[model samples]
Target: MKVELYDTTLRDGAQSEYISFTVKDKLRIAKKLDELGIHYIEGGFPGSNPKDAEFFSRVKEIEFDNSKIVAFGSTRHAKVKAEDDMNLRSLVDSGTDYVTIFGKSWDMHVRDALKILPEENLSMITDSIEYLREHGIKVFFDAEHFFDGYINNKEYAMKTLRAAEEAKASCLILCDTNGGALPFNILEVLNEVKGKIKTALGIHAHNDSDAGVANSVIAVRAGATQVHGTINGYGERCGNANLCSVIPNIKLKLHINCISDNQLKKLTEVSKLVAELANMSHLHNMPYVGRSAFAHKGGVHIDAVLKNPLTYEHIKPELVGNERRFLISDLSGKSNILAKAKELGLKLGKGSPEVKVILDQLKEMEKQGYQFEGAEASFELLLMRTLGLVKKFFVLDGFRIIVDTHYEELTSEGTIKVRVGNRYEHTAAEGNGPVNALDNALRKALEKFYPSLRDVYLTDYKVRVLDTTEGTGAKVRVLIESTDGKDSWSTVGVSENIIEASLKALIDSIEYKLHRTRGQ
Candidate 1:
């Protein structure tokens, strides 16, 4: 069976909170979706904003391989002609052959939101679709709030579908605009639509009820030929359906072909790619395309998985371009340690004493509020140091921070002295804050010794209070992220003083960078 995949990452996804896709971001995602073999890519509402309008004009230059770029907008206004409707006119000017326009399907929406007669709403749907069709544009009619509309007034909702069908819409897309429909609700409505309508059907689902993927699959099972979704479920409110999960469920589980096997493997890659471009961290727990999706931390689970992957894994991690990961933590057992060591290219006997030492050290560190989950670089450094295989690079002699405030303007200065082998370098630098000042001073003292250290810079810094009951005297944990452009790593430090904790993490970050740059 074949199900068409339509991506709205550039359109509906931009409506997500804290997400504002620039023209370049939209263009980049559209190209990725096209390469992944999506049947349709909803670029954006053509005239919604200057940025979106410019996106439509700029998108025309890039040629798509397997996807059609689509313009999205709403139906004509209650009193306006489709020819003169600004939204409808923007659709024609968008320069795309396929266009998606939504119409109010719920009677409450017609009465409240549109403030028009239910009959007038139907005319708007017919007129907008027909006008686009007259210009040789294939229209995808989105029936907004459709599932709610069907339950409240089946007669009026069916009338709206009939309106679009009568207007020769290329596809009738039923949208769960509020995203509260369960599978049974969707199945019931789809069965009714199949019995009454002849036009091709598609489903646009949202994740408010957290069944976006399930409802989309149910719609496909009920013979809806098309599925609409965003890349990582990014959208207004909760989110739109996640194609990252929807596509895999439809292809691998349902045994349907929405995209080729090669394109399917791009799921994880594209998921993270879109997340990075959106300036959001990729969800580590998201199904199919997440970092932790196939990760095993339990010792028993790891042992069973190594014996037979089917024991703990539902599917091969490689199936979706994600690899299995064995996390090393206090809960890890001998099997976990061995497997993790093997992954890290550390040769160890089955019963090596070093393994127990590493495990014990890990547990002790955790007790002291050290979390290695997001600090893989720190974990590896600690592991090597525990194994007595690490080389000392530099030793910190002492460091001091001084702050002066005058007229409400504060200046922080950091002074540091470090011994590199037989030599010592002392440096001082002023900064906006104590952490920044220390970072500058340290780099100033080390750049001449290792110029590559100049390329290493802090990317993220996070602090957590471990013992909040102690209030001002609480121990704090600081996690610092550093990158040399091509690669990034995270390190953690814990102390009662925030500056001391930050300094510890900063020191680990530099050591990790030097260890990495030396190709060790």
Candidate 2:
């Protein structure tokens, strides 16, 4: 049987700390999930809140090409009939064809958390499933904490599943609620329950002990037919099993085509997009879709890769919407430099004198905490400047900035003795901040010579305390990312003064833009 993949990114993912998706974010993420071709999407608990109810109501308008939106909730309360449970009524009213409900599978959870007898808990599970089925909604019963529950009370856990079977649940999902169960435990429990139940089983894992993916793999091998996860592993605590990791592992490694080939091609894009929507920086070391997933830094590795790509790379980066990067770092050797030079349309023979000079500059800058791996524009500008290809567009004049408690002021700012092709222009401008003032002043000074600078604008400014309580009283590192309506680039600067760092990065951004424009 074909194993199915169900995504719960928007619902369970919101359970992740510091993550709250706006309606716009939810819609965008839902569209991407649809594009990913997941078999099911557990949106949210409709009866739990107004936002989820609104999401389900609006989600009906979104036509998914490959996935079905599922409504997730819990079973009826103790002493309450399933037909009369408020939670069950909400599920039916959500208008979703599929409804997933979790019950007390563990004896401890039943006796302690729910404070009810195991028999009563089993009845609640059975009655809830049958009620949903009676209302024409397919029921997916989550045996929460299944592995641990099975280990503690095997007979009770299996009996609870039997209850689900009697009620005719469409699928019984085995959940690692605490997210601490290891694969061996999963395989053991799955081994016992694989053929014992008449219903198709599913695996819903979390990543507390970092075994979510491993447990998922083990369960699938043991005959589970469905995998539950969130994109980029977004969920409570350490997060859920990353569908980005699970899909490729199952599809490419296990020869199980869990998602369509077309969806597979857009996997990396969708993964990054979801990360963007979540406002979380994509983990560079994350397996297939990360920025550093296919990066090569060592010299020997680059040489071998250039000789034969398979020498260093296990699979083509393009297979997952990722690209290989030749990083320039201390470990980078001659092969790396030559490859980078070749990419920049520059010729560098093995052990060239110019290569030594450039390497010396790079090493010295790195010692000062410059990271060229993420600042390719700065690196390229440094290379060109060292090669005597850079032209000085203008010179900076004296400028003064003053700041007080409530108000700040910048004055006596204008270019003087500035040479631009045997002509000079003096100008001044005020802005919101000193760095902005400096930027405005510099642009005003150079606008006549480089009129294209008029179109440039700063979009992002990031500051880092490099040593975090060390290095010149927390040496400030600044990265300013800019765009000229057509292209974007980033530049970095580090200094003891935060303003100075910001100024330097701003200058680099402008100069880099100017150089590229001039060259073009």
Candidate 3:
């Protein structure tokens, strides 16, 4: 069966904490989702907020090749006619051919939330769908709290769906509003609802209990024609079912084609792109697209995967545009180094003496609280040194940094002295912090010798305390990520002094850039 994929990232997903989409963000994300072959993009509830209304008005200007835009709103108020309800009027005015509206499914909600009788709630749903259809809009009815409502009042829940069906709703979506329904219950209720209602069924699940994806898949197995979710499982409270997981599961595991196989390969890129736009850190352990999803760390697992990926992997990572990774740590073996070296374009044959030396060095460094897995630049430098390929770009003579606290504000100044071949340069600079000051001073010193250094800048800096037990004397590891417009690299350093650690990482960042630019 060909299942439809409806994305509510711009609507329900924005309800997630710390996630807000601007008009341009919504338009860009909609185009991205459309490129990923989403069937429908729920722009937002047009009448709920001015931003969403503006989004709908502006989204009409862009041409989406794949996905259809959906305007979301609630059912007409019990006290007003559907045609007179401003919410319904806004949905029509949004100029989207598809409209989705949620209505009260639980009898408790009808009485307490809407303050209306059960029949009147049913009338509200039917009237809203009828009104939208009369305006030549295809309506998808969201039976909010359908599972909970079914458990509380099966007859009323079924009647609500029947009302939507009688009003000729294009699709009937069962929403797990509380996100507490188990997969079994969802399957059972959906099976029953399938027999009761004639409209096409869809699943909209939340992740309060962490069963959102499971419930969504189970519903599809039972009988659902569409699945509604967010790109990264972003939503209120917990989250929505992650479409990143759901779409692949439907396509590969269930043998149902939700999106083309080529589009499936763009899953990882799309997932990260969405996270970047939302200004949220990507969850490394998220299924299918996460950084750690296909990573192998244990010696046994890494060996098995190296021999035959099927030995340790359930699915090929490349299928989802994610690559298998051999993580180097205390648990790493010779094979791991060989694979990593090969990946880095180094010609280190299996069982080479260089590999054993690098392995020994790595183990000793890891014992001293150095992590190479996250510091690829540091590892590469280590490999180059072991192979006798390292060339010093400059020699640091000395440096001094001063921190001043006056007028209730803290400022720092750094002075650096360096030698480039026979020429020496000394410079001083001030910055917001000691690291920034050091960076500024060092770059000023080297800019004359290596003008391309101006094109290189530190993009991110992270510090981790290796041993908190040491308290104030704990060894800190600094990881500096630098980008030279075209590429990015990460270098690591560890020392009891934070300044020394940051300087080591900074020096490595510069050397790596110089080495890539000039073979020497």
Candidate 4:
């Protein structure tokens, strides 16, 4: 049987406390998910919130190629009948062809959370599904906490699925809600459930124990026709099962096709785009699309991959919209240096003296906490310096900005001091904020040294509080990424004072650009 992958990134993924998508973002994501060739896209909970409901009403106008938008909701409230339940009614009016409804399956949950008898819970499940089917909507029944429900009371869990089955649930999704079940135990239950249910079966897993991917794969091996997951595993608590990991695993490892070759090429781009829209940093070690997924640094590995990429990499990075990178770091060997040199159109043979010199400087600089992993342009500069390509750029004659705040007067004072070439200049600027004043003053100082610096603008600045203490002291890391329309580079600074870190990175960005300009 062909396996179907259902993506709940927008619906379940929004359960993540940090993620919230605008209506347009949801529509854009829905179209991207369809582009990935997912069988179903769970958009959001239609009746639960205004944002989700607005998204669902607007998503009807979107054009999709191969995916059906699935609206998610609970089965029904305890006192309300499925036909009269406002939640179920909202799902019907949302204009989606398919709907997913979750019902309590664990005995503890049904008894304590709902305070209802087991038979009434079964009736709720049957009625909710039947009502959707009666309205010509495809229904996928999610037996919430199904794995734990099966473990505690196998008969009741099996009976609960029977209720959904009799009511014509298009598919029965068994959820590892708490994500505590091991693979072996999951396989055992999957096998048992398969023997009992004649309808299609699916698996929805969470990553609480860090085994979401493992359990999902094992469930598929035992016979799950569908797998549910979110992009990059973004969801409530630990996370949902990572479709990024599972898709490649199912296609490459099991030798089965989960999605078309064309759809797979857009995987990495979509992954990063979702992270950008959500304003969350992408995990660099994520299985298929991470920055370091195919990065090589060690000498032995680099040599082997150069000969045959399959010797080190499982899949070609291009297959998933990613690329191989040769990282330069302390652990780098001769092969690593040569590869990096080759990228810059320079030739360096193994055991070359030039390579030795470059490697030595890299190690010494790194010892002082200079990081090049995210600063490729800076690393290239280091290589040029080692090759004696240093040309005279304007000297950084010292510069400083001072800010003063007085609560009694409710006024702040700012001043900037600097030396340009052979002359010293002082500038004063006032702004609503101290940082704004400092930026203005620094730019004033630099314009005298290089007129072109005026055309270069600070396009983006980011500040992150790195470490926090109990109510008082904290360390901040500031990353200032700037662009000159054609090129962009990032610089970093870390200090206890937020202002100091921002200043350090800001200065580095300006200095690095001047250095590059001098070469040109």
- Those runs of model 3 whose alpha carbons end farther than 4 Å from true positions after fitting are 406-408
Candidate 3 has an lDDT of: 0.92
Error of 2 at 102 (Å): 1.2
Q: Model 3 residue 245 lDDT? A: 96
lDDT of 3 by residue, 62-90 (tens): 98889999999999987899889999999
Ranking by lDDT: 3, 1, 2, 4
Residue 469, model 2: Cα distance from true site in angstroms: 9.7
Q: In terms of TM-score, how similar is model 2 to the real structure? A: 0.91
Q: Tens-digit lDDT track for model 1 on 228-315?
A: 9999999999999999999989988899988999998888999999999999999999999999999998999999998999998888
Task: Return the top candidate by TM-score.
Answer: 3
Which residue pairs show backbone clashes in model 4? none
Candidates 1 and 4 compared: the better one by TM-score is 1
Model 1 quality (TM-score): 0.96
TM per candidate: 0.96, 0.91, 0.97, 0.86
All candidates: CA RMSD (Å): 1.7, 3.0, 1.4, 4.2
After superposition, the stretches of candidate 1 with alpha carbons farther than 4 Å from their true spots are none
Each candidate structure's count of clashing pairs? 0, 0, 0, 0
